[model samples]
Target: MAPKTTHPVLGARALNRATLDRQLLLRPASLGIPEAVEHLLGLQAQNTKPPYYALAARLEGFRPERLSALMESRAVARIVTMRSTVHTHTARDAVALRGLAQPGAIDRELALFVSRGGLDGVDLDRLAELARALVEERPRTPKELREELLPHWPAADPQSLSVAARCLLPLVQVTPRGLWERGGQVALTTTDRWFADSDGPAAGGPADLDETVLRYLGAFGPASVKDMQAWCGLTRLGPAFERLRPRLLAFQDERGTELFDLPDAPRPDEDTPAPPRLLPEFDNLLLSHADRTRVVPADLRGRTWSGNQAHRVFLLDGLLAGIWHLDEGKERTTLTLEPFARVTRADRAALTTEAERTLRLMTPAGVPHDIVFATR
Candidate 1:
């Protein structure tokens, strides 16, 4: 059978509008926090503040308190999922997707540590069990958890032992840690204990990978097999896409990579206007695709990535236009915007308006903020 192809091509701008619509960046969505999180597949939350900032940009009338409350209530959690990095997921996805990513994520992690002799003379199964018990007894920071496990595996590298448990077990970073505007250490508890009413990976194993692929496409698609792999850190998803190909709508980029998307998913017109959006650092929109030209321009791609660090970036006319940073002062907060290309006076005003809105979402009421446009 001939491989399916989408006729007439989706040009770069067309792909950009479609992607922005699906990501909720074209307009603020009406969905609540948990629903929005689920729809976006979860937000990259390596830091405490990005998820809050991300929600602010995507959801209408979003309040930091709403996300903070969800954290306090255990409705959402911070867990190491896709790409083996921390993400803020609704309690349900934290369990389901973490399980799907584990076989590969855990093996890679263990292999690296074992090569360093980090797990030498240590029985990993026993370490996992002990770590689970300690965390379940009460939420404990990685350092605290390490001290408790050291007695059991005295010769094992403390950092590696803790990391192995993280890889081997299903742990969730408990609250007060990810709560908005609150300071707390990175703490862990088993997903089983954190979401007592919910089922863990045992209830949804490899079978869940099928749903994972569909959900990824729903949120980030018209994407290639490599894009799916990049987003989830799972390899060999071509078969999963093949299995679902009969039901999916296929398209090809100008570069001719095969793309799959849900038939009913939104594909906005090429001219759909995308507002300037101030995205938090490591936002999934900037990281999810193999061919990021859909969102970030080809010539400007290297600007956002420095070594391993991805900077906070903003979109102007639906493509990455600049990078931004925030500095808080005792009396006022300043948001600095640095554009990679020339910005018109009109664009600067619009960018300032968006930056001010972001400041309001991030800081307390009556805390004044100033927007500074940096020299290119």
Candidate 2:
């Protein structure tokens, strides 16, 4: 049987279904840890520990321990890889994809610290030594490390050289620390101490490049080459796309922009019923695309994507419903929704009721928390 094909113009529904489907949020979370990680090309790990909940919400059968176990055993590693941020990903991916995104990582790190004193009078070799000595054996917080390094880099600012040197070199923050519901604190260690072999950089096609593009398309495609470039931070998807052109399925959007995807991947009916769902800060669905209109509402985009400050969000008939902030205190855990637009009283009430239920679930047994809707 021929594979099903979709026309290029994927509106909010198509985009939402694709996003949810890829995120595994549409279906109840059922996949194993490693499988889930492989599917999303890794969760947006910049926040370190939060992806576990992001995964748990999507993968019904998630075990927080599996990821920590992967991190400890080195089957997966915490590498300063994609988007030039810290993420815990399968070791195989860290080895392969980091090479592609390293330049961005390096640039971001350098820009962060160089101005304060990263490349100043001090010797870099010694700086690396100092950083290693500070964090070795045990993971250290950026704050704690900064305090210790103050004597060495008293003149340097935290942003410029401190974060940059780590970017240029390979390092991994140890975990057990990042597992779900666990008290996750940041700590650094050399990637070699854990994963040992670093994936060296290699130029396009015939190598991991094609496989990388295919994996990306399978997990995040039906997207343009530009989207692939944005997610991977790689400029050479042209050649990778060219290499896979024959095997890929293509369609032109309303603008005639070509989009590609794995021929065998799922593209559910546009009529698929999408439920209201909550997403973590830095969720990949929002960050993966160059044009996010399909999943994120323009009005709510600026606020909800602002990390924990934006809190959680809701998918109202597949469009964003602005930002949500959850406050958990001794007596109760409260959830507040900050909508970007005027929701009908009925929808507002319904959302409030659901938020209350969510609060109850988040804090079982004791006093059920209050869920409130607030105007932005």
State every prediction's TM-score relative to the real structure: 0.95, 0.79
Instruction: Compose the digit string of candidate 1's lDDT tens values, residues 96-199.
Output: 88888886656687789999998899888888888989999999898998899888888889999889889988889987898876758988999888888532
Model 2 agreement with the true structure over 1-376: per-residue lDDT tens digits = 9965556576556756766676676666667777778777777777654576566567654556666666666666666777776666776666556665776545555655666454566566777787777666556667766677668766766544457446655666666556545646666676545565433222221226787788887777678888877786656568788888899988655565778888788777767876556666777777777877768766655866444453566766667776777777878777878777888887776677655544443454677577777887
Candidate lDDT scores, in order, read: 0.86, 0.67
lDDT of 1 at 206: 38
Candidate 2: deviation at residue 336, Å? 2.6
Minimal lDDT window, size 10, model 1: 198-207
For candidate 2, report its TM-score.
0.79
